[model samples]
Target: MAVPRQSEAQEYIEKQRIMELFDNITAQLVFHRPDNPKTFMIDYVEKLKESRTTQLDFPCLFDESNIESVFGMLDPTKKGFITSEQYKESTQTLGCDNVDPSPAGSDMDMITQDTFRREVKTGLKKASATFEQV
Candidate 1:
């Protein structure tokens, strides 16, 4: 069976739902660290900036720019990788509870650049899917 087109009311409701989700994400980020706090980690601050940019409608799509931004957040040392702990912490902070802390065949302590991107993209795709279903 073909899916029916969304009505104007349905579209408006979807928009409202998206707005609410972004608002909550913003509040969570701020609660974790206020704007321009000196003691706040630069990584967290950058993530906050990304979220704010997304909320401001800067193409929330997981494109090259967004992917690179998130990668930089995870690889702040510029060492080309992040620890599994960092991965877990970052995902959890962003309300992504579906990420497995320990995926098979990977060292649970050290996450390589490739692994980081793959896992993050997976999470983003899952989040998008869930949001679309709203």
Candidate 2:
């Protein structure tokens, strides 16, 4: 088989890692909006800026850049909003060509990734510590 280009390998690694992160974010993301859309957005933003996992190895919860990227995850157009219809459409093509912009809105259907994210962490305390350091 032909060797994959260096950039290709790097891209693969990064994609795999971020996809895993997205899976984890989905867990909290689901509970995020149950009561209030306004607070949910603020809460979600805070969670990203401030990691709260018990493990320390995962990405920092609130890395502004990652949070911003997460904000743009589904918004290729960069409009900064997602709707229920747009949310549902994303699940059909995750891990395939279907999920191009990465569904900036929602992905509860792909909870398998959430499981992976939890497994990667050791404890909420440890995870929280990691977020504070940054």
Candidate 3:
């Protein structure tokens, strides 16, 4: 979409935040260096960036300031990242958290590191997937 202009301050800010999150995630995933995996989570941001052909996407939120929206949608309390307990709560709320892969499945939701990237895609928009449906 040509990138929303400053008039859409809200939109611009949100995109920036999402990008920041993507960068943070990209760095983290790069650190872990998981084995050849089909899905993301460990490589969410980088994969998405490659998938989208742009460095402006995150798996956490579609918008930056709206990251809390994800917390609300997934976590709700705004306490921050998902821990074991918080993950359970997120599963109940997100329902689809199970769609992610978790070899351990001990995290209460059968979610593995791969799930984070899939769901975060919920909020991101790559030039390629922009026309995609939810």
Best by TM-score: 1
Model 2 TM-score (2 dp):
0.26
**Cα lDDT tens digits for candidate 3, 1-134:** 57666779767656555555545455445765567543556456455556555544434323444434545555455433445444445544543333333323445533333344344344244321322223
Can you write out model 2's per-residue Cα lDDT over 27-113, one digit (the tens) per residue? 545644356655755665466555444333333334435334433566667554544344444332222222323332235433232
Give the TM-scores of the predictions, in the order they appear: 0.46, 0.26, 0.25
Candidate 2 or 3, higher lDDT? 3
Give Cα-based local distance difference scores for all models. Answer: 0.58, 0.42, 0.45
Which regions of candidate 1 are displaced past 4 Å? Answer: 1-61, 104-108, 131-134
Number of the top lDDT candidate: 1
Please, what are the lDDT tens digits per residue for candidate 1 over residues 1-134? 66656786678667555654565455545666656544444443455446454643222235556666776987887987777777788766554556667753257467776776666666654453324332
Q: How many backbone clashes are present in model 2?
A: 11
lDDT of 1: 0.58
Write the candidate numbers in order of decreasing TM-score. 1, 2, 3
